[model samples]
Target: MKCIERIKYPEFDFKEYKASEGRHSVHDYPAMLHYLLVNHLIKNYSSENSLIYDPFCGSGVSIVESLKLNRKAFGTDINPLALLIADVRASNFETDRIRDVLDRFNIEWNNLTPDIPEVKNISYWFKDYVIKDLGKIRTFLRTVKDNEIFKFLLVVFSQTVRDVSNNRKGEFKRYRLSEEKLKQFTPNVRKTFISLVEKYLKIVETDIIPFTDFKLFLQDVRVSIPIKNVDLIITSPPYGDSKTTVAYGQFSSFSFDWLKGLNPYGDGDLKLDSLCLGGKKIKEQKELPSGHLYDALKNIEKIDEKRALEVYSFFYDYYLSIKQVVKTLNDNANVCFVVGNRTVKGIRIEMDFITAEFFESFGLTLENIFVREIANKRMPLKNSPSNITGKTSNTMLNEYIVIMRN
Candidate 1:
C-alpha cells in the first residue's frame, strides 16, 4: 500500500546502451535485458556472495551478470534453448581445447557424411546443401566428449541455424521468406558457424572467469521450488503469453529442433509457446487480485471475450509464478520485475501496477517503478492483436522495472 499513492514512473535512457554486447553477444536472445541495467540492480540491491534468482531468466543475462559480480545466482525457464544458452554463458571453457577441437572437426568434416536432422519441414526452412552442412556440424559435435565444449558448440550451432533458416530475420515469430527471397538467400552455414564459434571463443578467452555457485534449471517456476534465502530477484518475466506477445518458442524452434537430441522437453512436441504462461485455454475465468487487472480485463472483455480470457489466464499464471518466487525470498530481500504494458484491442494493460498489487497481496512492500525506453530490445514495433490485416497496434515502447521488498 505504501509508495502506491506517489506513483511516478521516471524515464531512463536505455536506448543508447547495448543488451547483447561483449561476452553477452554469444547468442541473439529476443528482448534480453541491458547488461548495464541488470548490473546496476544486482549491485544496488545485494551484497557480494549473496544469492540472486531469476524465475524467467531469458538467455541468462541476470545469471551471467550476477556470477561476474561474485554473487551466487539461480535461474529457471520452461524453454530448453534458454537453459542451454544460459548454461553456456555462465560456464567457463578452455580456449586451447576449443581450438584443438575445431582443428579436429575441420579434418573430419570433409570425410563425414552428414545425416540431416528430423526437424519437421526441414527443407522449408533450409536449403538441401545447407541442411547437409549443418548436419555435418551436428555429426561432428557428437564426437565431442567434453560437456562444456559440446554446449559451446551447440550455442554456435544454434546461432548458425537461425542465420541460415528461411525464417524471416528481425522477427521472434516464425515467418519464412518469400520464394524470391529464399532463392536469393544463400547462406554459408559452415562459414557462419565457424566464424561464430571463433567469435565466441575470442570472448571466452578474454572474459572467462570461474563462478562455481551459479545454477541454471529447465523448470517451470510455477511448480518448481527455488532455492531458499534468495537475497535479490532480478528478472524480466514474459509480458504476456508467447503466442500473443513475442513468440520465444517460435524464435527458438529451429535451434531447439537442431538440439533435440539434448532437449530436456523431449521430441516432436515443439510447443514451447503453448507450455508458457496462459499458453493454453482455461475452463473458467475468475477475478484476479489486482484492481488494475480487473479493470483492464473488463475493458478487454467488452471488446472481445475470448481475448479477455486469454489475458486473464496469463495474469493468473503470472500470479502463481510470483507466489512461488516470493516463498524463496529472505527477510528484506529485494525483487525487480521488468515488464511492459502491452495493448490488447487498444486497451492498455498496466502490468506494472498489477505486478505491484500482486506483490502487495503476498505481503511484499512496493518500492519504485522505473520506466525505461526500449532502445534496443529486439521486438516488433507493431502487431495485429485484432488479427485483422492493416489493423495494427503499437507494441510497448517502454519497459517498467517494478521494485519491491519482502
Candidate 2:
C-alpha cells in the first residue's frame, strides 16, 4: 500500500450520515472518532473477517464500524459507562423485541414506585421533580428480563439523564448553571426519555445486522491485555491525561452515577479521570525511547515544573500501554492511532512524532502520519491547562492519524 505524508477530510462530514452508523449515533462521546474515519481505516487496514482490536475504545466506534464492514472486533475500556455504550452498540438487537420491551417499560414506569439511588449531592445536579421522574424510570428498568433490552433501555434513559440535568450543556466538565439560569430551567424528564427511546428505536432498527462476534471488556489496557492475535488496531486514545484534556470520566459521571449498580466493573467512585491514562502522577522520571518526548518535557518544565511532570506522567503511562499492546499484535498487523497535539503552557507537544518514536522502539515500522484538520470533532475551543483564569491556551487545531505496521 502507498503511504501519504498528509491527508485532508474535506468530504467527510461528521453529521453527514445518521442512520447508516446504527447505534454509534445513539450517544455522543467526547472527542469521538467520526464513523467515516473509522470505516475508512478498517476497510484499508484489514481484510473482511479479520480480527480487530481497540485498546481504548471509548464508545465503541471502532467495534461497531468493524462489524459493519464484516470483521470481528474486541474493545476494552476502564470506564463502565463507555463500556456499556460500546457493548450496547456492538450487540445485535431485534426491533420487535425492543418495541415489546419498551411497551412493558412504559406500563411498569407508571406502576413502580420511585427508587432513587444514593448519588452524592444529587440535588445539586437534579431538581426534586426531575429526580423522582428519573428514579421511576430507573426502578422500572431494573425489572427488565432481557439483558440486551435492559441495556438498550438504560442507554436511552442515560441520554435523557444528561439532557435534563442541571449541568450545563455542551461542556464536558460538571459545571452547574447559575442560580438565575437554574430558575428558568424546566426539563420534562419523562417526555425526554420516551422521545429518546423512540428516536433510538428507529436507529436500532436500521442498525440490525446479522450476528457478528464482538467482545467488550471493562478492563484497563494499561494494566492487563485482554485479547491477542489482533490483525488491526483502530483507536483514538486520550490525547492527554483525563483531567486536563478530555474529562471522559467527568463527562459520563451523571449517567454512571445513576446506573452504577448495573455496571459490573465500576468502582462506585465517579472520579474516572484519575483512573485513566496519565491520570496518576509518577514520582520518578526515567529515560524514554522518544527524544522528541524528552525535549517536549524539558520545554514544558521551563514553563512550569509541576506541569512538566503531569505531561511526563501521561506519556510514561502511554509508553507502558504501547509496550503491552505490542506483545498482543500479530506479525505484520497494522495500528492506527488517532492522536491530537495539544498545547500546554504555550508549548505544543508533538504527540505524532512521539507516537511514531515509541512504536519504532518496539520494532514496528512507521508507515505514515496523516494530518487532518479538526473540522467537527467535539472538543473545547480553548482550555486553561494551568488552571489559572487568564492562562488560556488554544486547543488542537488538527489531529494526526499515525499508521504503523507491527
> Which ranges of candidate 2 are over 4 A from the true structure?
1-22, 264-268, 381-394
My TM-score estimates for the predictions, one after another, are 0.94, 0.93
Model 1 bad stretches (over 4 Å): 1-11, 263-269, 381-383, 386-394
Superposed by TM-score, candidate 1 places the C-alpha of residue 126 at a distance from the truth, in angstroms, of: 0.8
RMSD of each: 2.3, 2.9
The lDDT values for all models are 0.83, 0.82
Kindly give the stretch of ten consecutive residues in candidate 2 with the minimal lDDT sum. 385-394
lDDT of 1 by residue, 1-406 (tens): 4545424343355566676876688888877888888998898999999999999987989999998999999998888788788888888888899999999987888988786768888888889999999888888888888888988998899899999988877656677888999889999987898899899998887886557588877777878665799999999998888776767787788888888785433432458788889898886977667999999999999999998998899999999899899999999999999999988888999899999999999999998888777667766543474443222234567888899999
Tens digit per residue, CA lDDT, model 2, 43-157: 9999998999999998888988998888999988888788888887887677688878778776776687888988889999999999999998878888877888888888887
Clashing residue pairs, backbone N/CA/C < 3 A, model 2: none
